[model samples]
Target: MAEGGYIDFHVHLPWREHDPREAARRLLAEMDSAGVERAVVIAVEPSLKLFKERVNAETIRKAAADALDYLVYMRIPRLRRILFSPEESLNEHERILVEHTRRSEDVLEAAEASGGRLLAVASYNPELGPIGTLERIKGKRYLGVKLYPTLHFCTPNEKRLRPLLDYMESEGLILIVHTGCDPGIWELPDLCSGARPSSLEPVARRHRDLVIVVAHLGSYSALKPGIYFDEALRLIERYDNVYADTSAVDSFLVELAVERVGYDKLLFGSDYPYVTGLTIADFVESILRMNIEWRAKMAILRWNAERLLKRLGRL
Candidate 1:
């Protein structure tokens, strides 16, 4: 690891707009400006096969209706209270899934050319089937697999996912699960029900040896902030192997997390490209300006992630 620079625990490559190499270059330039020594670039794979199997015509119709309702609710304050609707519709999610599918190969290729400045974490969708997915990623230098429970329309504890989970545990690969809320179609609570932090408890309990990192600190919701933060704290406090990333969480909440759980289990993450209006430098500066001691700030910014990377033999 570099001597004195931030190790971002979360970031993503630009979607289909840029190819892998150009994406890596842009990401590296951003990191350089932010004083980030390295970053873990997580791939986002919204499988069409999974979407087709899970979503029917009725679901689409309901999504369109809900979307219209959400728009109306946003325009009227009374409707906002009465409906309590989500910001995104199911139809929007379908469009994103179909149009913005990111492959693990793209992420790996980008990181390969990043001169060790980026670490790749592959995305897995169970709809592709475990045997083929595993075979495809076998012997590839991915640090771990990232699972999107809400987007994939499955929970972490599903029996079908056991084979993949078991393989990750046995192979010493970390599991980064998307907790809290997501944007686009998954903004609806019903669609993203599996994203709640509590949903991961069964998996954490069953796989004691597996290292699990909950993304977004269980509070990435744009409409309902910190919705599952307490549950995330519960998992971190109860399970020795469970950790969290502070991506897209409010600064006050980041401070609150330190107060509740300390800095040891919290990793710095910018959720880059997705964090509108703020640069990676802005996220790093926020941590630096916190009221905590320098040691605590450094732990969150660098050392904590460094320790994890070293353990995984990636540093």
Candidate 2:
């Protein structure tokens, strides 16, 4: 790895056992090719099983329609998995929790196998409550917690989650919440509504010491209006603990993010595997092309993330 090497703040590790090790191998290979020194690898958080149980057919139908719109716009094949096989569920919350545990274990193993090139982040559904989830990860070697409000159908400021946020702050666990819009098998509007960046404001204010990262820079709606891109920017501007990542968004949004959020708070992230058609190399190259100084670009690509990991005691 180079001195000031690139660190991917976001990347997904597969839950499917069919060939997850091989998939991770491919991911590491891509990272090596792209000159990514290290990556914070996380497990997929969406539970199709939970969605199947909690959502009604009308909502699923709406989600299907939204999936169609997304498919047409993005022209990606991965989105079809949720639409064609909507019945396939991961089971109930218990099953989902079990799967998440297994996925976290797999990620830890992958991190170990990487010989320190990968850092594992634990993913939990806040719906099950934080105490039980914390018990599962007790004494585990992970740097952060991954939250998917859109997939879990909850908000960060939910009364029940205050303890969880407090615990994260106490434990020095970085909270990487999935913000902005999410599509595929889940109801689009509801998921988007739950994950809006503003929803995190209260929690960010309360847990001012916790490191909060709003993934995708809250521009999940692309260049369209009605999303929380501006809200995300405001949070970062208002709170020193709040930060944003450039994951699964276009270069235009990246330009906007750097100009507004500044380089110190921006981190490089690749929503790999889910962010189809782009390799880690492509993602890194996009940042290289952005109209920013080399030092700022390096900060976004590595220094900022490395600094955060050090603070979290992961580095």
Candidate 3:
């Protein structure tokens, strides 16, 4: 955990009434302590506002601010960067009761003003519009399409989302989905309860060419107390395009997941704001203490993501 190399693909940013730079600096210090080399900073499109109203306590974390935090504290042997998706990018087609439009240009301008250390994910909810809306995005800033089935009022299996998924598949874009056999809450479960990773079978069958990345490795679920592990793993088995991350995950589960999935199929992520170095390092230590080979263990920590990114030309 001291001095080594690791790339964190899934990390979050804190946007709760603090200087974005300061928040990122604190996070960077923590990442340094954990031996994380580079990080893929991800910001979601503020799609949440459509579904959930603000309680006086919690503020929305914009995709741009998350990217800003990463840049603010970016300096080290650190490949500090972020993946940001404005919440409103996907809602352009629909006529909401409220007109909440966080345009891609606006998100980009805010991010550029923050200096550097930012990249983005272009989000298109084909549910909102099909050919025109999605076609508007040339996708210069984004690595791929980020789909929030829950926030946009569509499940992954919905016929409406299929066109967008199909576009991504045909275009070879990386499609990141929120999965795990989930409940029915727009903020909670974007995909349907029946739309588990296994539920993605339809999409997988139709779009075998797409690189479907499942967020948090399908960690958040209803597997009883300890029975859900196999259910999560079932996703990886079900889809070849499926990939999982270590974001927002606890230590024991991370180690167990590495054991089950092996290092090749896994990636590192903090689900930041919600994720922390202490949370990830503790898991790394637990896994390293086992009799596993150092290479496999280290691959889970760092090498795996590197290979994937290289394949995507991010490296």
Candidate 4:
């Protein structure tokens, strides 16, 4: 931890059933131990309940629409009351909305109690319709919105997500999107095809003012080598608002990011909890050891993200 302290641009809390307080506490402990000043806790949307293991465009399109419908209906107070009043008795669709909504509230509560140590971000399946989710994010304390097209089953440039991207630009909210492959043992490879970084080119070009983050540096597991790193790098180089973070990757890739993407468009992020091999301190130290200037390291570690957050009035 340098004098400015490290700001983790990418972090996650438990997505499954768990105690919110405990989850927040675990994150804080990691921050304190790693000398992290603040970490953005993202409210994650539940994964898609696809009927087939092999996902097709038509199936994804329908699922995306269904996801949007659920999020939109969730905005109704009576619907929320009715569903949550007997949450234990909810069906699959009802449970997804209830769970995602509750997760958003939980992160907000944790951030409130964090005393400035934890910042919150909200994520939704953009293909599902960003309007409802974007509307849900408006006026909230969350500094940004996260989109996981890979797991949630959609692409960044999907026709349905245009309005949501527009809303984010006007509202001055940052967007941290997962733009790589998911090779988790339990994941469906077919569903992740849409997470490619190049899929975002259309939206990035359309909304030049919107701040976009390509997480994991567009790198993927061994199962999918050379996935979208080139596309992510091109996006960062092509658009001033486009940025990338070093999360769930190795130091070699960080070196490549610094050499190729430069420090201004790069942010430091320890994917946390999910990164079992290294500690936050290890990631920081690796950056320190890079063959780059200290100033560049400082920007990646804190100032770069701080500048973005300050513009959004999140700081």
lDDT of 1 by residue, 1-315 (tens): 237689999999864456899999999999989999999999888777777677654654455466564445354332242233422333445676765666889999999999999999998856676666677677888988898887777788877778888888888888998988676545556567798889899999999989999998889776677878999999999998899999999888889989988889999999887776778999999998888878888899999999988987899
Ranking by lDDT: 1, 2, 4, 3
Q: Kindly give the stretch of ten consecutive residues in candidate 1 with the minimal lDDT sum.
A: 78-87
Q: Which is the better candidate, 1 or 2, if ranked by lDDT?
A: 1
| Stretches of candidate 3 exceeding 4 Å from the true structure | 1-4, 16-30, 46-119, 123-133, 181-195, 221-228, 276-292
What residue runs in model 2 are displaced by over 4 Å at the alpha carbon? Answer: 14-23, 60-102, 185-187, 222-226
What TM-score would every model get versus the actual structure?
Answer: 0.88, 0.83, 0.64, 0.78
Clashing residue pairs found in predicted model 4? 68-128
For residues 3-77, write the lDDT of model 3, one tens digit per residue.
Answer: 346766655444442444554555465566667666554444534454444211122233224335433543422
Top candidate (TM-score): 1
Against the reference, the lDDT scores of all candidates come to 0.82, 0.74, 0.52, 0.71
Off by over 4 Å in 4: 14-17, 51-102, 125-128, 185-190, 224-226
Estimate, for each residue in 37-82, the C-alpha lDDT of model 4 and write its tens digit: 9888777665444313434334434443544543343444433433
lDDT of 4 at 220: 62
Weakest ten-residue segment in model 2 by summed lDDT:
87-96
By TM-score, how accurate is candidate 4? 0.78
Give the top-scoring candidate (lDDT).
1
Residues 33-142 of candidate 2: C-alpha lDDT, one tens digit per residue: 89998998876555556666667545655665855654465543434444554444323323444554436667777777787888888877544557766776667777
